[model samples]
Target: MKLSLFLVSTAGLWVAANANSVNNKQTKNDVCTHPFVDINGRCLFVNNFAQMDWDAARAFCAGFQGDLVTLDEANLLADIVDFIYKEGLTDRSYWIGGSAGAQTGAFVWPDGSLVRMGTPCWGVLDNIQRPGAEPNEKCIALNKDNFFFFDNFNCEGEISVICEYKFQRENRWAEGGCATMKSSAVFVFLAAALLGSDGATEAGSHVKTDVCTHPFVDINGRCLFVNNFAQMDWDAARDFCAGFQGDLVTLDEANLLADIVEFISKEGLTERSYWIGGSDRALEGEWTWTDGSSVRMGTPTWGANGQNQQPTGGSEENCVGLDNANFFFFNDFPCVTAMSLICELKL
Candidate 1:
């Protein structure tokens, strides 16, 4: 009797432990609040099963933290279907990530244009082409009712959707080290707004001295100062700025202008003819900034239309200057005179 009682106690304990383990797993899977299944390193979600239209299904995916499936990798898609199966998702038709929405002869994911193409397979047999396959349908749909058969459906037709967000490894900086990523560099600039361009000058002086004054901080970029009083052709000024990892200074916003002015004031550049942003390479009659942005600043320093007037003969003037007056517009100048420029780079 004692032996039987001991055996029964052991069995009861094992059952209790097994039940607890199962409950823990269930809780873990249920933790995701978004309509998604976390698998491998991505979050996957499927939209409701309804025949609405492609656009509607896309919007639904956007709402649920993903987009219509653009399966670049075959294994990933298989994993997704397995998840759907476990969840008892019986959506007969589902939209996926293949579309020729932008142009013919090419397929692109609606999510982003940067995704690279990978092995294409569909359904149980992993066949890209099948009998009666309408390759020109432009959009693909998975028919779950027919055991996940792939179909080329009209883009206008509505169906369910699946979304996936790949996991990104956040780069954490070591202690005492600054953020090193490009995005982090932008954030650092925003946080401090430290003055200065990424300009530099090599030491040619024979005298050993700490006599030079720094008008701005390096912030991992360089800065160059041009005396406004000095007359320089547009080309020379551009070359000068280019030598320092910058282009001819173009002021698109008031705050940017203010920053330049602050730097100039610190550098004691009070009365020089600095180069302004103007280029006419693309369209001889039209003016554009160095970055190809539109030159929309009103009331240029060289006077309105003063820099843009078409002269009687020489090659269309392609450069401009900022006079002591109307500071925004460019005054036409030749391209080869040496002038000051500001260089910039993300720290």
Candidate 2:
């Protein structure tokens, strides 16, 4: 009955561009890691069974390596509403990412991007926002009773969290729309051709044969091994790579970074986030690889959550990993979090 009611209110939904609304239709980029579902190119984790206050909800989502879902686009909001109704979820208030805590009346996502205001985004009654006080409140959510439009509620109010994982596809091929959803095999081939990769080696090729024979399938390129089977914390993951005469993977060339990401995404190895070799443990913000080389920061290298930059976690997240949410772009994660890893050693 909820979705049925929402379908008739479609005219109220308008399109606004944001990280999660890049695609018009529902298409999955990578397989949603268990407990998440593909919704219009976003891997969403919906927990209607648990309820927590605004702050607690944020911490809960972070445990899953995601932030609260931001519904910047009208269509995405509509899709989520329909999804809840169809999935037989209870018609109750849900927590979203926007917050006015920093500055009252101005809502922003976790990455500090201003939450789009007005319109089909907010519920209106007689052409006026249902609750005039909502805009000045601290946290934002989809008011289920208000036809699922953005509404501000007190931060302490208990509610279910709907988080969105920020998955990015920043490969150079995207300039021509290559990132657009397509068959896995076709996309992989196109990416390989454009980036000069052959998918030549499998994950199991970490064994050595001769002086010229190495575990990786390469001639002179980086000897890298993707560990898709085991998951471990940052230190343990690094030790595993050490046993193979390698450390966590590090990137110095932009093109090589692109190739590795494409290989992982296309080859279906995105089920979990990966531990790379960059960490700021010695000095906060001084990111360096295991060999003590500096790690690159900023666009095309570090991924973003909406408008929020990567490595924004500050002191809490000292280790860097290729986040699945950012399409393998570098993301700062807590060292304690368990994940798969990439091992690299020069041949």
Q: Runs in model 1 with CA error above 4 Å? A: 1-32, 111-120, 123-136, 165-347
Superposing all C-alpha atoms, what RMSD in Å does each candidate have to the true structure? 23.0, 18.8
Clash pairs, candidate 2, are: 166-325, 167-325, 168-326
Model 2: lDDT equals 0.61
TM-score of 1: 0.34
Q: lDDT of all predictions, in order shown? A: 0.43, 0.61
lDDT of 2 by residue, 1-347 (tens): 11112111222321112223224444345555535555656667667767899999999878767788766544456466666666666467889888874645567767665665543355443435433564335888777655555677888999887876655211212211112222231221111211222233333332222221233332124556677889999999989977766678776444445556656765788788889889999999999987787885553356543345578999999999887754566789999999999887432
Tens digits of per-residue lDDT for model 1, 1-347: 00011112321221011111111322233333344444433445554444567777777666655577655443344444554564556655778766655644355555433222211133222323221245546676665643443455777876666664322112311111111112221111222332433233333211112221232232212232344544556666666555544566554432234334444544566556567657666776466877676664222122332123222224555665553333322355555645544433212
TM-score: which candidate is best? 2
